[model samples]
Target chain A: MRVGVVTFPGSLDDVDARRAVTLTGGEAVSLWHASDSLQGVDAVILPGGFSYGDYLRCGAIARFSPVMAEVIKAAHAGLPVLGICNGFQVLCEAHLLPGALIRSDRRTFYCKDQDLRVESTDTVWSNAFTPGQQINIIIKHGEGNYQADAETVKMLEDENRVVFRYINGNPNGSLHDIAGITNERGNVVGLMPHPEHNVDPVTAPTRDGIGFFESLARYLGALASRTQGGTA
Target chain B: MAKIIVDVMPKPEILDPQGKAITGSLARLGYSGLSVRQGKRFEIEVDGEITPERLEQATQAADSLLANTTIENYVVRVDQ
Candidate 1:
């Protein structure tokens, strides 16, 4: 599988995201924010960072980047896309996912090892994990609180779209303890935690994040086989 | 040139952490009975006369790019 990790200006974790992809046996393709092309990669990952300096809003300006035009289009066409941290903010700003991320309830930046419960493994990005499984991942952000209207929250719950929920304690005070979510089609996913940061055993406290990349590779391989079978 | 000013504010039902922090800070500083709701303001310059249609256009633009309607409500008015 070839995964393209986009590096917007001020992007800090694109390299780690690429390394995670490579570690999971996928080709990591470097992509730029100014380019409109996706480079024909099978999947795309928008890594964490202060894109456009997190100006105005966390992802308000970066959503208009040329690459997002293609990302949005391809995402709607059933392409698998994952947005981590600042990338998750970008996805929300782009309206690919519902709701918004406001300042953390504490109004301070938080960096710690977060415990997350896999609320749903129905999406392509989370299939490797079973529902209700607890995973430890790192989270770092000041404006990571997730919120949505009550109606939308109900809808997401009814549809089983809420992907991950914070366990033990709510770090940022996200509504319903939501840490990650997927679109209705399950092709696009966005999470506030840094899964890529946990892929390496030497640096990460646990190799728990390897599940995300492994899940993506399995999903892409299954998708490719389905396409080939359809043609055959 | 005409300027269209847009203000985007968080929905009343939504929690504004930044505003809450400010309110707390003010209370600590001996301020009382005051509340704050932080918002954003944008000034846009248009190339033509500011007509009702232009104002409406700016309003529409505000809905798409200037704000996230999911959690915010925006008001557009011509800059006097």
Candidate 2:
């Protein structure tokens, strides 16, 4: 499997995301923010960072990048896209996912190994974990507070589209403690935490993030089966 | 030439941490019975005579990029 990791001009975590992709048995392909091509990778990732220096609002400028046009198009065609941290903000700005991330309620950045519960396993990004499983991932951001309309929240809850929720404590005052969510198609997933930062035991706080990368293989396999008319 | 201004403010329902911090500072400095909400202002210069079409375009820009309608509200008007 090949995973494309897109690097925006101000992205700081693209290298780590590429490494995590390779470490999880997938070939890592470096995708550029201006190239306007996906390079035919099976899946794509938008790594965390202060894209475009958080100008205007986080991920607002980056959404207009040339590469994002292709990403947005492919995402609609069922391309598996995983957006982490500021990447999540980009997805929201791009309208690929609902909700917007606002400044932290604490008026300062919060960085820690945060606990999150896997609320759903139907998405391609969370299928490796059981329902309601708890895992620790690195959460570092100044604008991780998630906000959405009440009706949107109700619909997400009713549809089981919420993939992850903050546990132990609400770090950024996110509504309903939502830390992550997936599109209705289950191919696009966005989260405020940085799973790429904790994929290695030697240089990270926990290895719990490997599951997110590993799940890609399982999802692809299931898709292959479905194409072959084997009940997936 | 004319100036088109776009003012953006956090939605009333959304928390404005920056604005709240500014309020705290005002209180610390002995300001009483006053509240403040921080927002952004953009000034766009138009070279030609301001017309109805240009005003509509400015409003569209405010809606499309100058403001995020999800958590913010924006107003577009002529500055000069």
Candidate 3:
């Protein structure tokens, strides 16, 4: 399976994201923010970093990049997309996902190995884990606190869109302690955690982060098989 | 001409630890009478030639970039 990792200016995690994809047995393609093409990759990953120097708000300027235009369109067409940390900020800024990320409740940048519960395994990117499974991943950001209105939160919960929640503690005072979420179609997932950094056992807080990349690879492989059979 | 003010605040569901810490400090400092809530505000100016619809679009543009809808709420006003 081929996965594209987009590199926006100031993106710090693109290399890590690509490495994770390669380690998971998928081809990692480099994509530029200025391009509107997906390079025919089966899925896309928006890595983390202070895109556009977090100027005019985090992920705000990055959302208007040419690549995001294509990403938004492909995501709507059921192409799997995963946004991590600042990528999550970009997703929300682009309105591809609901809610927003603000400064942490403590008004301090947070960085640590975080425990998160797998709330939904139905998403294309989360199918490797069972629902309710707890795993550790790294989270680093100043504006990682997630918030949304009560009605919207209720709606997301009812629709099973809440994909991940903080297990040990509320790191950033996220509403409902949410750590990650999926779109209604379950193809687009966004979270303020650095799963890419945890894919390798040597570098990972634990081996838990590999599940994310492995899950996406498995899903894409299955999709390829289905397509081949249909063509035959 | 039209003017819009947007106020962004963390929703009530999420605890504002910073605010709490500030309030605690205030109490410790004997400024216990102060109540504090943390948020962001924006003042936008639009030209008179811009229609209400156009101004609303501009406001939305600024809001999506300047305000995070997940953690912040925004309100807009027009002045003639």
Candidate 4:
């Protein structure tokens, strides 16, 4: 399976995301933010970083990049997309996902290996884990707090769109201690933690992060085979 | 001309430590009954020639760029 990792100006985690893809037995393609094409990759991952220096707002300017135009379209067409940390910010900014990320209540940058519960495993990116599984991933950000209105929050809970939740403690003040979410179709996933950084056991807080990439590979590989059979 | 107002706030589920700290400070200062939640507001001026589509585009721009949706909520209104 081939996965594309988009690199926007100021994106810090693109390399790590690509490495994670490669380690998971998939081809990692480099995509530029200024490019309009997706390079025909089966899936896409928007890595984290202070895109556009987080000047106007985190992930704000990055959302307007040319690549996002294609990403938004492909995502709607059932392409799997995963946004991590600042990537999550960009997803929300681009309206692919709902809610917002704000500064933490601590009002300071947070950095730690976070424990999270895999609340929903139905998403393509999270299918490797069972519901209620505990995983450790790194999180680093200043404005990682997630928020939404009462009605919207209720809807997310009711629809089981809430994908991940803080297991140990609220690291960034996310609503309902939400650490991640998936779109209604379960194809697009966004999370505040850095699973890419945790794919390697030597560097990861734990080996749990590999499940995310492995899951995506397995799903996309199956999808590719299905397409081939249909064509035959 | 059209006037647009934008209001932004942290989602209620997310904890607002900054707002709480401010509330604490206010209580210390003897402003006992004051309630505060931190957020942002923007007032924009639009030309009368702007179409509703264009207005919506501008609002989306404001939402995507000017506002942080992860921790903020925005409401837009156009005043005649």
Candidate 5:
């Protein structure tokens, strides 16, 4: 399986995301923000970092990048895409997912190992974990608070699209303690936590974060075999 | 050239942490009975007379691209 990690100007975690993909037994491809292609990867990861110097707004400018045009099209076509932290902000700005991430209610940048609950495991990103399972991941950001209208929140709740919710306490005042969510199709997922940062046991608190990549591998492998079988 | 100014702000219902922090700081600095809401201002220069149709087009663009309608509201002004 091949996963593409996009690098926008000032992106800090594209390398880490690529490492996570490689560690999960997949080929990691580096994609550029100005490029118009995805390099034919099976999956894509929009990694974290302060893109464009966090100017104007987080992920606001990067949403207009050439690569994002392709990402938007591919994501809508049911491609597996994951956005982490700043990448999550880009996803929201791109309107790939609903809601918006505002400044943290605490009014300061926060960095900590966060506890998250797997609220929905049906998506390609969370399918490897059982629903309701708890995982520890790292979250570091100033504008990490997530907000949406009441109707949209209710719709997300009704559709079971809330993928991850903050456990123990709501760190950034995200409505409904939402840490992550998926689009209606479940192929696109975005979260404010750094799952790639937690993939290595030596550096991170746990290896629990590797499940996201593993889940994608399993999904893509099954999909590939099915396509082959259909042709055969 | 006409300049279209668009101010994008967080919806009233959403929490404005930056605004709140600034408000607190202002209070600490002896300013009272005042509230602050932080937002972004965009100045768009277009080549044409600022007609109603052009203003309307600028307004639409501001609403769709300059602002995230899900969490924000924008006010567009046409300066001739």
Candidate 6:
């Protein structure tokens, strides 16, 4: 499967996302922010970074990018999209996902290892992990606080859309200790932690994050099999 | 040219760490009984007359680009 990684002007983690994708049995395609074409890739990832120098809001300007327009469209059409950190902010800004990320309530940047419990395995990104499984990953960001209205939070809870919940301690004062979440359809997943950084044994703390990439391959395999089974 | 000003602030329900930091600093400086919240202001110059339609345009701009309505409240008005 070909997974496209869109690089915005100030995106710093595209390379790492691409590496993680490649390591998990997918071809990584380089996508540009100015381009609207998705290169017919099976999946897309808006990696973490200070896009547009984080001007105006974390992901405000980047949300207006051409690639983002297409990504948003594709995501609504059921194409799996993963947004990490700044990417998550972009997803919220783009309205592909619910809620918004704000400056950490602690009034400080957080850069440390965080344990996240997998709350939902229905998304293409998290199907590899068992329910309630906890995985350690690196989280490094200044604005990782997630917020939304009471009704929306209630809906997310009722719908089982919360994909990841922070364990041990809430690093950034996210409501309900929410570190990540998915859409109703579970096609789009956004999170504050850096799963891309935890995918390799040589460079990362553990391979805990490889499940996110491996899950995509497994999902595609299941899809291809279903199609074949239908024809046969 | 008509200038439009957009003022944006964090929503009351949302926590404002930066604003709290400012308030804490103010307290440290002996500014008693004072609370502070931080926000942003944007000034945009329209090329033509400031009609009602132009005001609507500024409002839409504020909604789409100038501010994130999820955590912020913004007011767009023609600068007098």
Clashes of each: 0, 0, 3, 11, 0, 0
**Model 1 clashing residue pairs (backbone):** none
Clashing pairs in 2: none
What's the C-alpha lDDT at position A121 in model 4? 88
> If you score just chain A, what TM-score does every candidate get?
0.99, 0.97, 0.98, 0.97, 0.99, 0.98
Off by over 4 Å in 3: B1-32, B36-57, B75-80
Candidate 2: segments with Cα more than 4 A from true spot = A228-232
Q: lDDT by residue for model 2 over A1-232, one digit each (tens)?
A: 9899999989999999999998889999999998988999999999999889999999999999999999999999999999999999999999999999998899779989999999999999989999999999999999999999999889899999999999999999899999999999999999999889888889877898998987889999888878888654
Across B17-78, the per-residue lDDT of candidate 6 in tens digits comes to: 99899999999999988898899999999898998998998899999988888889999887
List, residue by residue over B16-79, the lDDT tens digit for candidate 3. Answer: 6667778888999999788777766667676665577966785686466666656655666554
Q: How do the residues A1-232 of candidate 1 rate in per-residue lDDT, one tens digit apiece?
A: 8899999999999999999998888999999999999999999999999999988788988899999999999999999999999999999999999999988888889999999999999999999999999999999999889999899999999999999999989988899999999999998999999999998878889888899988887888898899999999
Compose the digit string of candidate 2's lDDT tens values, residues B1-80. Answer: 58999999999988999988989999999996778888999999998988889999999988878899988999988886
C-alpha lDDT score of every prediction, in listed order = 0.93, 0.93, 0.86, 0.86, 0.92, 0.93
Per-prediction DockQ comes to 0.76, 0.87, 0.54, 0.51, 0.81, 0.91
What is the lDDT, from 0 to 100, of the residue A14 in candidate 6?
A: 99
What is the lDDT for A112 in model 5? Answer: 89
Candidate 6, which segments miss by more than 4 Å at Cα? none
**Candidate 5, residue A95: lDDT:** 95
Candidate 4 Cα misplacement greater than 4 A, ranges? B1-64, B68-80
Q: Write the per-residue lDDT of candidate 6 for residues A1-232, one digit (tens) a residue.
A: 9999999999999999999888877899999999999999999999999999999999999999999989988998999999999999999999988899999999789999899999999999999999999899999999999999999999999999999999999989999999999998998999999999998888777789989988888988998899999999
Q: How close is candidate 3 to the true structure, as a TM-score?
A: 0.86
Interface RMSD of each: 1.1, 0.6, 3.0, 3.1, 1.0, 0.6
Question: Distance from true position, residue A67, model 4, in Å?
Answer: 0.8
List runs of model 5 lying over 4 Å from the truth: none
Classified by CAPRI criteria, candidate 3 counts as medium
For candidate 1, the per-residue lDDT at A131 reads 91
